[model samples]
Target chain A: MNSLEFYVDHLFRKYKASIQIQDLRFEVLGNLEAKVADLTANGVGYDEAVRMAKENLPSIDHLIDGNRTIYINQFRLEYVQITLLYMVIGWIVAMPLQFIRTGFIHWLFLISSAIIGVVYLVLLANRKNINMQKIKAFNLNAVFDLRKQVWLVWFIFIGMSIFITTALQFGSNIWFFRPVDISGPYQFAMIAIKYLIPFASIIVPVIFHIAPKLIMKYEVGENDGYKE
Target chain B: MGDNSISRDIIRGHIDAIILRVLCEGDNYGYEIIKAIAKNSDGKYELKEPSLYTSLKRLETQKLISSYWGDESQGGRRKYYKVTSLGEEAYEKSLADWKIAKDLIDKLIERQD
Candidate 1:
């Protein structure tokens, strides 16, 4: 690696690896390299060109767009908590499906869901252990990006619920040596609605609405300031 | 354009506009834009790396300019920025506004003699 690339990498070492950050790093290194090339072309020594290039970059803080920074580890932990909570909700909604099939698998799923919920609660209790040094700049775009992901998650959750519940209703009957029952239109419609009851887990995305608030809680206090 | 600190501060505030003005001529990359600014100012002003990048990013986010990576034909892949139609309109508006401001300031700060 060239001196300019090394210098730029050293400056960026503290920030987490992300697509946006990687792009920024590429842009910064390319520009510095170009500057050094220009100076060296003008009869300047290679080492002096590197020094001048480094000097030209007074600070990179302004290039990172955000007035406030948040502890990235804590923010990630929040997403994990959110995922576990959704699992608990899904499994809870699926619990009632046990009445329809009457099986050991349903009991296992219900127990596992309870365990996941308990794990989420425990993580929430111990979140104070997260390091304060892992910082990420906070911006409104991040919130919007998160909302988009949450919407996708909800979409997948609902789609899977419909699929699983329908599979359980039809597939289980055949699994136990029973015929695939397609009675009348009325019975079919009733069964469809009955199996799709797990869609009630749609309430999980409500956490998405509250996610911005949760993220705000992990923001580094103004007094702590972002370390360079 | 002058040695006056106040003038330099005013120029700094309009770095976005200045960068836009350069792109209005043709699409360019980061180092080239900095060089163009320095050359236009007769080497009087050299834009700092941080300020140039920050302005470029802000302008991109504002939809004033869009960027793409050029192929590795030259020296590696350089990010070239092009002005959008929206950017052209913004540059015109800012140029007009600066003209009026310049006129008013000249009138207000005229020598008493």
Candidate 2:
């Protein structure tokens, strides 16, 4: 296992599944191979050393993916907070567009738009909240376990959203303003309003949500307090 | 460390200096460095693989050591390392530090025997 390229080729066939190394993760593998060679310097042969090296290198994806689950779960917590805040804020703003002005037709558009915003937030949260456990349940071959709390989280979320939205729909304070005709520009505005909040949630959190997890997953084990 | 308890760590920290001192005039690999350490200390000192590799990585990171490929009939390929100019400076510093420490220790440990 002295020459890393030669050692990797030999070990790749022995792993049972044919895998192509896709990422820049070969450096870690190389360093591990070097360690294996060093260990067997006096005892095992080169072939044995290579086998040991491969055994030591569990899936890089699993190692990084497990860490990613933790980051994303926390990110979802932040996202859920922001999304709930947005809904509260949207309702405050749409109140003016609804009861204050009391346009006859604005009530229909307002309620529908708010429904869409709340639904979008719940759906996005559900998708991203998938923890490693569910990922394992989905794929049994997973070498690493994702944090378990995320599954309970999404269930609670969907259950709460269902309860809240249904309660709001049947609430006692059903004050309908004058019905606005949602057939022309009002229809288009309604459609835009439905999608706008969701789009912002997706885009704003895209950078925070995607970048930190990628960096964490592919971490080189910097000397941070974390075990990595 | 030559089985001496008191100055072991101080001597161990100079492993780079000791290896580079041997490799200064010639390129050497791992086993060669281990053998040189043993020989210099009259078979009293030895370097474990972890110590050797850790020092190598540390030196390389500091640009004080450079490595190249070596072909061998027994092994497929080995990385042969040489001390760089920066490594020479590190070796000199290690030597001076050791010399100062040795003088102070000898003075303290000296007896009328």
Top-DockQ candidate index: 1
TM-score per candidate, in order?
Answer: 0.54, 0.39
- lDDT string for model 2 (A1-228, tens) is 345566454534323332223221343443555556676876888777766655544333332212222333434445445545544554555455453344423444355457756765665667645652221111112321222333344456556665565355434344454343446886666544443323222323332333444334433322121211
Each candidate: what lDDT?
Answer: 0.75, 0.52
Instruction: State how far residue A175 of model 2 sits from its true place (Å).
Output: 12
- lDDT by residue (B1-113, candidate 1, tens digit) is 45676667777789999999999999998999999999988988877776788789889999999998877666545889999999999999999999999999998999767
Best candidate according to lDDT: 1
Ten residues in a row with the worst lDDT in model 1 chain B? B1-10
lDDT measured at residue A197 in model 1 versus the true structure, 0 to 100? 60
DockQ of predictions, in order shown: 0.24, 0.05
Candidate 2 chain A: worst 10 consecutive residues by lDDT?
A132-141
Evaluate candidate 1 and give its CAPRI docking class based on DockQ: acceptable
Q: Each predicted model: what fraction of the native A–B Cα contacts (within 8 Å) does it retain?
A: 0.44, 0.00
